[model samples]
Target: MRRLLLVTCSALGLLALLPVNGALAVELPVRKAGLWEMKVLSGGSVPEMTMQQCTDETTDKDMSTAMSPVAKEICSKQDIQKTATGYVTDSVCGVAGMTIKSKAEINGDFNSAYTVKTSSHTEGGMGGAPRDSSSTIEAKWIGACKSDQKPGDIMMPGGMKMNINDMQKLKALIPKQPAK
Candidate 1:
């Protein structure tokens, strides 16, 4: 359960990371307010996952406001540059005693659809050995959220819907591990 929460938190961190250069932090453009479906593809131990998110501008901005400070505190290097193809971000951050160096290229406009390809190498981390991974995240605007859903609500895999802001509720969703 702890591991799952850690993974969740890490994923949230990645979603909001932006370039920080000597206090000149550039805010990433907010996604269109509504429902967005995201599919993550990877060849690592983790399998492909899909989720839908209901978001508003303020919720998205709040995530950035809440996370950037933590990123700046732990990351010695974080850079982003605009490219002809799209935008590219490079970062080196430490979490849970592991150092992660990554480069990601983002393509497509956020209003409709977008793709982000990321490659990273991790050292001295959870597995206790160096590891490399690559992943692609494709997301698209999926219309409005159901009346029952609220902003920051994410329909995670397995059809569990939880608000990103109420993280404590996530503990109930993670399955327990067997006795080792």
Candidate 2:
């Protein structure tokens, strides 16, 4: 009877050591606000300018000779404008014939939503030479942050969506061991 009781107690202790599989609990980290900024700079060549002028020295000659250079000068400015447009267009998207500088800021509540403010400046070239513009966008997250019980993963939500693939990719990006 004593041996039987000892065996039964040992078995119960071993069973207690075994992990319980159902409904494992995990602790999730609190999300916080983050900020990022991006800037773009671009430039192009200047166009030549032509102006008509009267010349007293050449007054004896036909007035047409003096007037010819002035006409060419005026037309050259137009060609410069066209060339600058072509260069700027090739360099940046949706932004042409001007140099653009922009700034953006975001204030985020990791749990719920975020607000963004952006502003831009453009300059150089003819016809409405320099201008500045600003815009804003607001966004929200769909769900609360959560953790996974699996060996190598954490689950989280971003901007009104739960991206399982992103979570997996993020898991891969994290190093298993710290660098020396």
Candidate 3:
């Protein structure tokens, strides 16, 4: 469930980067340097959880695309429009024979707080059944990072800390595979 929310948040992060003019270019509002708390609620099927992250300017920007390994690989095209309240996006993407059509509406000031509501439908999913889901995420600034926490450090729901930027280090932690 947590992983699902994280992935949803990743999509929202991409949405946040949309230009105010509705351009596809990534232009994210600068969130203040501090600790942030995000609460995610995805359908009744998943439990709600609040996760905190510490960020600085660089970290905040990097986080926007952390989960987006390849935009073109996933989304064929994404259309974003600025709404009176926040922004809206209509996206289409496909992977592994699964096609996803999604729409998202975001509200609130990204500098301090914001909420994203999203609904998506997937066809040809793992179970070969059409899947429809909706999720809401609320995030707000929560003062400074803790003494032990630094920029780019994310504290997952299970109390595990990770620096996503240090992929090499994480890879090092995994034992190498033996030759066939």
Candidate 4:
């Protein structure tokens, strides 16, 4: 009878461990390559020149000129949250800011997560000119082993451009295994 009880308890313990092992076995899907779009909604004045000024200015002919102070200020003040969603197949996957190196797969049907980084440097303005500055921003999607493709060209709304290969590499570092 004691032997029977011991065997039963051992069986129960192994049965309990099965679910745990199954849970640990879950694999994350891979990311793929495709087109991704993102938008920034900011609070502040929209930069625009009056019609009269446009007619008078000969040097500044482009409508999409450099960002004005008000525009910059607004962009700085507003919180920026970017959400990326798209499809992935064996041939292609599309996400904003990164090139799909390889196709993403649905390992266990969980959505991937991402991280973003941004930096800017501004030179103090001189002689009433707007401060000279530039910014570099990168966004990385983290989770699972997906695409082998590195992040590549990113397109902004109204046709802006950025490079995000490095960021994608960083995101690729996310471990495929779950914690024990």
On TM-score, the leading prediction is 1
Which 10 consecutive residues of model 3 have the lowest summed lDDT?
171-180
Write candidate 3's Cα lDDT for 24-139 as tens digits.
65344667888988787788657776778788888765654543433433565577777887778777766555667778887888668988787878787456999787778799
Model 1: per-residue lDDT, tens digit, 91-124? 8777666677888888888889989888888887
lDDT of 2 by residue, 1-180 (tens): 533332322222212211222211211112222211111111222121111111122231222233223222221111111121111101111112334444444455434544435454556534456665444434444332233222112221122222212332333332232222
What is the model-wide C-alpha lDDT for candidate 1? 0.71
lDDT at 16 for candidate 2?
A: 21
| TM-score of candidate 2 on Cα atoms, chains taken together | 0.25
Comparison by TM-score, 2 against 3, better one: 3
Regions of model 4 farther than 4 Å from truth: 1-35, 47-150, 166-180
Shift in Å, residue 95, candidate 4: 29
Which ranges in model 3 have alpha carbons more than 4 Å from their true place? 1-26, 65-69, 166-180
TM for every model, in the order presented, reads 0.80, 0.25, 0.75, 0.20
What clash pairs does model 1 have? none
lDDT of each: 0.71, 0.28, 0.66, 0.23
Which 10-residue window in model 1 sums to the lowest lDDT?
A: 171-180
